[model samples]
Target: MIWDLFVLIFYFLVVFYFGFHFAKNTQKEDDFYLAKKEIHWVFLLLSLVATETSSLTFLSIPSLSYKGDFRFLEIAIGYIFGRTIVALFLLPSYFSGNTISVYEYVGNRFGKSPQKTLSFVFTISRLLGDGIRLYVSSLPIAFLMERMGISISPEILGIIALSILSFVTIIYSVFGGFRAIVFTDVLQWIIYIFGGIFALGLIVNQIGTTTLLEQIQHLETLGKWKVFVFDYNQTGDNSYFILFAIIGGAFISIGSHGTDLMLVQRVIATKNLVSGQKILIGSGIVVFFQFLLFLCIGSLLYVFYEGKSIPPDKVFSHFIISEVPSPFLGILVAAILASAMSTLSSTINSLSLTWARDWEMDKWFSPRILSLFFGVLLFFASLIPYFLVETWEKGILEMGLTIFSYTLGPSIAVFFLAKDKQNLPISGFVFSLFFLFSIVITVAIGIGWKLSFTLLVPIGFGCLYGLVSLSRFLKKN
Candidate 1:
């Protein structure tokens, strides 16, 4: 037990030291935000993949497959197509000029009003969404502590985990800037993926490959390997119809990668647009295979447990605590932390950069102070999930998506309108405003409308596009 704790602490110390070591290289704002525009596409690609695949995905994806099947992989296919569109179309606009923030395009097209609004929206969405992510990541730690004979409650354990995660991540991110974030993210990407592979190897070794394959084949006979959903009404979170999945997937990709500053920063850091394109598209492929490996692991767990009842999110963590032994167990926990800190560190840095760059703070300590401020905010925000655990019965993945859906549609719509230089009207703004309010209505008022959260992105974009067309028609007449 002491050795396992040492391994975990050693990983944190190494990451912190790297961050401190790289801080000396960042001499100015450009280096801090863009890594001096010298980051290679491979590191950027790995960082991008690692950022999106947060601890939430690491811990929750297996639960998704255990509770469901491979239907979620369809969204991944859409992810590839959507990123291709971003690479071919949206990225050109960003590269056409020196864009420090993705929202700069909005400011140049519409005005400060829309640009600031979208940035605010991005900050809020990231805070809530990643807060939920922080909470989900702590679950495995909580389980581990209990296994080691710790008597703390789950909520306290969660808080302890978040505090430790925030402290370690922020220590490096504050000093190391973009270079540190990218390099650490690459390392984290490897650790977590290796954790998944190690877990699978353990399973295969225990049961023998042939027996595992036989069990997986049996599950396939029971339709557990199913990937596509045809019916519209039947589709819910993690499952989608063909058309809706593609459309939703594309729009969400645009909203996230195309507009969200956290990801856009990575792309803009590359030497050229071509490099950006390669990284963007390559991440899609990597994520597809990554999801498949985790889902297959879930299937193996299902068979190993002989179909015993387990909570959806707890499946993987329970396995780690009850089954995984010694140093490997420590490695798996480190993987989960890596999944978390990569995303959290990137987010904190982005938030600070957006404030410093967009808000025009020239002081050297502006980004650092902002990083500390946001890190603290995120730590407290993470506590919300622990309190809501009983009330929020949906799986962690769905919870994260649901929070994103509230603002993502409007955010995406405004970007599309800005791309065409369309003059957004007051009504258009109202329509965008409704997108945020509708979530409250759905939850609080129980409105008759039953639209799935997955479809919100396309619907938001379609509405804004229609408004833009209508305004142009009236002016022409």
Candidate 2:
């Protein structure tokens, strides 16, 4: 206990120090909002990694990996190609436009409807998305403490973690804002990178080199690590799904990678197009492999505990609590805390910036007022743990991922098509928006549907509607 306390103190101090470090220099909206638009390519790379390698990714991807090797990777492959498209194609428009909120550019390109639609969608999606992200990532810590006889319920555990996270986020975000978030993210990158790598080494050290290979051979024997799921048998995984994913995956990436303020702010902070583009591309390469390391760690955990009655998602936590040696336990705790807090802080700061900038909610409500409302709303949302622990567990895991599809997919489609000189009318935006929501309703009825499928069903109809409407408009004009 003394050791854990000391470790937590060290972790807290490192992050807070950086937050305070930048707060001193922040003096205006741009500084707090866009890091004064002065971050270099290096910081952009770190921020890009920080935005994705959030607490959620750290917790959930390993769970996914422990379940099956390529399921998460399959999604990630499609996602990464989308990132490449954003880096090369869409990122420059930020430079050309010179606005902080990327959605603001949409309003200029298509119309006010698109801008407001995109902004509101981001708000709704992120609240749920980041809320679950906050709740689930910290679950491991709470669970670990319980196993160590700390005596706490998951509900109480959820509050404790959310409180600590909220405090850190509020403090830093109110103090320094964007520069603080970006600058501090680099520090988090170091901690997460080193911590995960250290765990990998320690796991390997416990199992000798020859023995590790033997374990890997065991995995090969069991057929756990294949890269591709190609089914030439015509009934295996289905190629139509693959083709849809490849295309739709890119679209999802545009919404997440290009349109997300968490990332757009980072790229906008860069000095020029070339530097920003390289950082965006380089970050994609780092990101693809970052999760690979987590998946590999999941693979190692399988070998270490060859035949235990346990859950796949719990493997990493189990290793920490029961199997990981002490002393390094302190380092490991610090790493988990870093992953959890950095993600929370960055996200909180992001939501703050997004609302404070995009909504101009400041015109109506004070920052403190908005914070109070958000802090309360999120508290309720985090209790999703109780439900998750109870009857809600299943194969879907789509609630958090799919919420973005309704509004985000259409907004992204409009932006992607409209930006490179494609013409979309005010009414076209209306048609696309209508099509998006109707699909979201049916998708709810058909739970377990993938985001790609849900999004495509609407987008295809929206495109057809757009073309017909455009022809009618041409005739009238």
Candidate 3:
């Protein structure tokens, strides 16, 4: 236990070193936000993977496979298709100008009001979505505290964890900026991936190779290896049904990768259009394989536990705490922190950039100041999940994805609207947003429709576009 704690401390020191080291180079807004547009495609690719993976991927994905099968890979399939669309269509426009925020393209295409509105939407969505991610990341910390005999309510423990994670991340982010974020993300990606592989190897070693094969075969018999579900029933919210999963996944990808400033900022920071396109599409493939690795970990975990009735969300964390040995356990815990911090840092930087650049807040205050302010806001925002976990029944992965689904659809819809030659009035955009929100609230909360969360993206896209078009037509008539 002592050795494990030492390892985690050492890891944080190393991350801090990277932050201070990079601080010297981040002297201006461009450096703080875009890394002077000098990052290589390979680095950007790794950063994207790291940033998006978060603690949810590290902790929850395995639980997914442990409880069910590999149907989640269907969404990964849709991710590839969705990213392709973004590469072909969105990348060109993003690269056509020297905009810092992705919303700039919307502003250029439509007007400033729409750009600000989109940025605000992005901010709120990222706050809520990544806030949930922050909470998910806190789970392991809370568990570790309990093991250490730190007696406190789970909520307080979560707050302590959030404070530690948010503080270190904010410091590095304020000083190091985008370059530091990208470089550290690359390092973090390696740590967590290695940790995951190591955990899987440990499980394999414990199970014995021959027995592992038999166990897998037995699992196949139990339908645990089922990857694709072709359910045709559309009367209910079957998210994993092949068509909904694929189409919904694609739209989600479009909204997240193409429209969201957090991921888009990485691609836009690359050298050229081709580099941006390469990294964007390449990330989807990498993510697919990454999910495969974690899902397989979950399956083997099921085998290891001999079908113990473990809560899917707690499966991996439970394994880490109870099953894994000391110092190596610390390494895995550090890996979880790595995943969490990477995303948190990315969120801080991206949110700061959007606020500073889109709203022209940079004119009033320094970039570092804005970064600090948003970091604090995000820290507070992350604590929200403590109040929400009781009412929410799904795992952290699903919750985070659902939060993104709420805003991503309309945000991406605006981009699609931008492609039209006809000017979409600001009033029309406002009305469209209102319309989309009403439908989302009605389906998701008011009536509690069984609509799949995956479909939210497409549904939102259609609502926003349809209303915008109708508004334009009505004005013309």
Candidate 4:
């Protein structure tokens, strides 16, 4: 245990070293935000994979697969199609504009009011959504604390974990800028993937090939390996319905990869249009395989535990702490931290970038100052989930994705409206109203209809587009 803790502490220091090393080169705002537009495609690809995954992918995905089937892969398959569209259509516009914040396009296609509003929306959504992610990432730490006889409430532990992560991430991010983030993300991607691979190998080595095959056969018999859900209901959380998965996944992917600045920021930071497109499309394939790895870990875990009852979130963490050997266990915990920080750091940087660039706040505040400011907000925002865990029944991944879909649905519609060159003949006030309505409908009203959160984007877009078109037609008449 002592050795493991030492390794974990050493890893954090290494991360800080990388961040500080890169800080010297970040001379201006553009360099800070876009990495001087000099990032290679491979680093961008690794960073995208690392940033898009949070503790949710590291911890919760396995739980999801343990309790459910591999139907989530269907959504991953849809991700490939969704990003393909973004690469082909959205990348050209983003690179041509050369703006720091992607929302600038929203301003250009819509109006200045909408641009500022979108920035505000991005800030709030990231604060609330990534806040949940920050908290989820800390769950394993809470487990670690408990085992070490550090008796504390999960809420306090969550705050402590978030603080530690935020502080270390901010130091490098404040200094290193975008270049540091991309490069560190590549390092983190390797660590976490190694952790997953190592854990899987340990599981297989213990179980032996015969036992592994038998377990696989048993899982297949139970239909646990089923990948597609043809249900017409469309209301369930994991509905793998053919059209529902593909269409909803496409819209969500487009919304996230294209409109959400957290992801778009990465692609835009790449060298040029072609490199950006390759990175965007390649990430989808990588995610598909990554999900496969974690889900298989979950399945093998099911075999290891012999189907014993375990809390969904605790499954992966429990194994690492109790089963794995010393130094490797420490390394795996570091990987968990890597997964946590990758998203948190990106969230902090992207939020600062949008506030500084989109709202034209550069005159008032530097990117580093703005990053520190938002980092504080994101830290507080992360504490929210400690209180919410009781009410949230779905796994961490589902809840996070749903919150993202609801909050960002309107923003996605606005992007689509911009793309199609359809003028929204409405005030920012009216747009905000419908935007809130989309969230209300998805969470509150969709309850009765049983609408899955996956469909929220397309539904929200359709509703917004229809209303805006009708108003425009009436004005013409």
Candidate 5:
């Protein structure tokens, strides 16, 4: 208990220092928003890397790898296709706006309704995402400890850990702004990718040099990394599912990079379009390997727990609890904090930026006042950790990502068609509205209908016709 509590105290002190350290750098709204567009490709790469590898993925990848090394390879194949599309289409769209709220571009292309509607979706979706991660991250760690005879309530630990962590993140974010978020994330990213890899190496060394290679061979023999679907003829999980993973991965990448404000906000800090593109392309490359590295760690865990009784999510935790030495435990905690900080800081900063600009609340209150307003709201909001956990477990997470199909898809479609052109007619809203309505109806009918037809049927036909007519009408001019 003392060792663990000491670690917690140490984390709070360090994180608080970074938060206050960066607070001075954030002066104007621009600094708060995009770090004054002063970020470099290296940091941007790290920031992007850390953001994509959330704690959930960190916890589960190893779990899946441990349970069946094959699953790691299977799922990572989907990420490859997703990252490819993100590098190509999504990166460009974000720079086109280079402004607050990626959805503002939707308003420019489509209309006001689409922009407001999409922002609401992004905000709510992001809350669910950040909330879910914030609530659950500490729980997994606590569970691992109890198995080692360290009794602790996950619920209590989650609140305590999250509150302090969230407070630390909120400093750079809510107070210092994007500079604090991205720059600190760049620094912290080192502890994670490197520390995680080093831990894997230590474990491998402990097992024998061939341990990793043997596991990979074992996983391959079981067909773990196969790209095609599990049950091809099921119609639901058919061969075409890879196509879905690929296509959906492509579109979803755009939805996140192009539409989601958290990521889009990060790109605005680039030196220019060229630098931004460099970061995107560079980060995409890093992600391919990063996923492999973590998944390898997971696969090794799969080998480690060949006959043990433990949850898949608990594999990495088990390793940390039982294997990691004390001095380096602080190092591991640093990695965990880095992962947690990357997500929390980005979310809080983005949330503050959204409120200040979109609500035009800035006109009424000073930045200090606005920051206080957001801090109070989020602090109270964090109290309902159960709702976040329930929503995440109940599939609200994937749905939140799915909802982006409405705003981001049309925005990209419009951008593709509307380049070097004048204002789109008010009828552009018709297409946007169609996409929104289709997604809403699909979500309302429930997840199955969404998976089946929400996107492909209505918005597909509606946007095709809208763009075709739009092109003809432009030619007549």
Candidate 6:
């Protein structure tokens, strides 16, 4: 236990050192938010991966495979396709101007009213979505503390864990800004990937390679290895039907990668358009492989436990606490922290940047102060999940994705409208947003209809686009 604590302390110190080191160079607005537009492609690529990975990816992805099969990969395939579209179609407009907020593209076309409206929606959705992410990140920490014989209630422990993470993430984000985040993200990426590899190695060592192969073969007999879903009948009941998964995944990627400022900021930070495009497309491929690694880890865990029943969300963390050795256990915990903090810091910085640029909050406060403020807001937001845990039944990944789906579709729809040669009417844009939200809210509350969370983005995109187009046609006639 002492050695484990030492490892964690050391990790924190190293991250802190990087934060303060970058603070000296972050003297300007561009330096703070866009990293002076000087970051290398490799760093940007890894940072983009780390920011999106979150603890949700580290924890919840394996759970998906543990509970089901590899059908989730279909969504990942869709991610690649979606990013490719962003690179080809949407990115050109972003690069055409020197605007700070991506919504400025909308502002330039339609007006500031729609631009700020989209930014506001993005801010709210990002906060709620990442609040859930913050809560999910705290779970392993709380679980680890409990295993270490801490006598506190899990709820209090979760808050403590969340506070510690938020503080460390806020410090660097406030001081070092986006550059610091990109650098630390590279480090965090290494730690978590290594941790995943280490865990996989140990599992293989215990199972014996030959027996592992035999066991996998046996598991395959039970359809555990199934990946593609071809049956259309399963569309309503299954989220991973290949067609739905791919289309939904693609739209989700478009919303997340193309429109969300958290990621768009990364693309904007790259040295040039080509560099940005490289990382955007490359990240999808890297993520597909990353998901495969974790999914395989979950499948093997299933084999290791001889198919014993375990809650999918708890499977990986439970295994680490029960089976992993001491110093390595601490290292894996740090790995989880690495994943969590990377996303948290990025969230703080992006939220700060968006508020400062989009809402003109910089006039009232410095960027660092805004960073501090949002960090506090996010910490409080993250705490809400603890009270609602009994009611929210979806896994962390699905819930986080659902929260994102709410605003992502409308946001992406606006961007699609912005790309057209004809300018969309502000009234039409406003009406479409209303229509999109009403349907999503109704579907979300389980009011007389059922839909897979995956379908939300496409539904939102179609609704918003269709309404805006109709309004445009009426105006033309």
C-alpha lDDT values of all predictions: 0.80, 0.66, 0.88, 0.83, 0.60, 0.85
Specify the poorest-scoring 10-residue window by lDDT in model 3.
438-447
lDDT score, residue 475, model 4?
83
Q: Model 2 TM-score?
A: 0.88
| TM-score computed on alpha carbons, candidate 5 | 0.81
* True-structure lDDT of candidate 5: 0.60
Candidate 5, 130-241: lDDT as tens digits: 6655554565445435644655676665566666666666665666667766767877777688668877887787767677678768778976555355454454422135
TM-score of 4: 0.95
> What is the descending TM-score order?
6, 3, 4, 1, 2, 5
Candidate 4 displacement at residue 12 in angstroms:
0.9
Per-residue lDDT of model 3, residues 104-128, tens digit only: 8887876677788888878888989
Top-scoring candidate (lDDT): 3
- Winner of 5 and 6 under lDDT: 6
List TM-score per model, in order: 0.93, 0.88, 0.96, 0.95, 0.81, 0.96
Backbone clashes, each candidate: 0, 0, 0, 0, 4, 0
lDDT of 3: 0.88
Model 6 lDDT tens row, 1-477: 777788989999999998999999877788999977888989999999999999888888888878788888999999999999999999988999998779777777876677777777777777787888888888877887888799999899999989988888889889888899999999999999999999999999999999998989987987778889998764456678788899999999999999999998999888778988999999999999999999999888888876488888889988887898899988999999999899989989988888888788888898899999999999998987778766877887888887787677878878887888876554646754654564465356432455677787887777777777777788888
Off by over 4 Å in 5: 1-11, 68-98, 144-152, 210-216, 225-231, 235-240, 366-435, 444-446, 449-477
Q: How many angstroms is residue 384 displaced in model 6 relative to the true structure, after the best TM-score fit?
A: 1.8
Q: How far is candidate 4 from the true structure (C-alpha RMSD, Å)?
A: 1.8
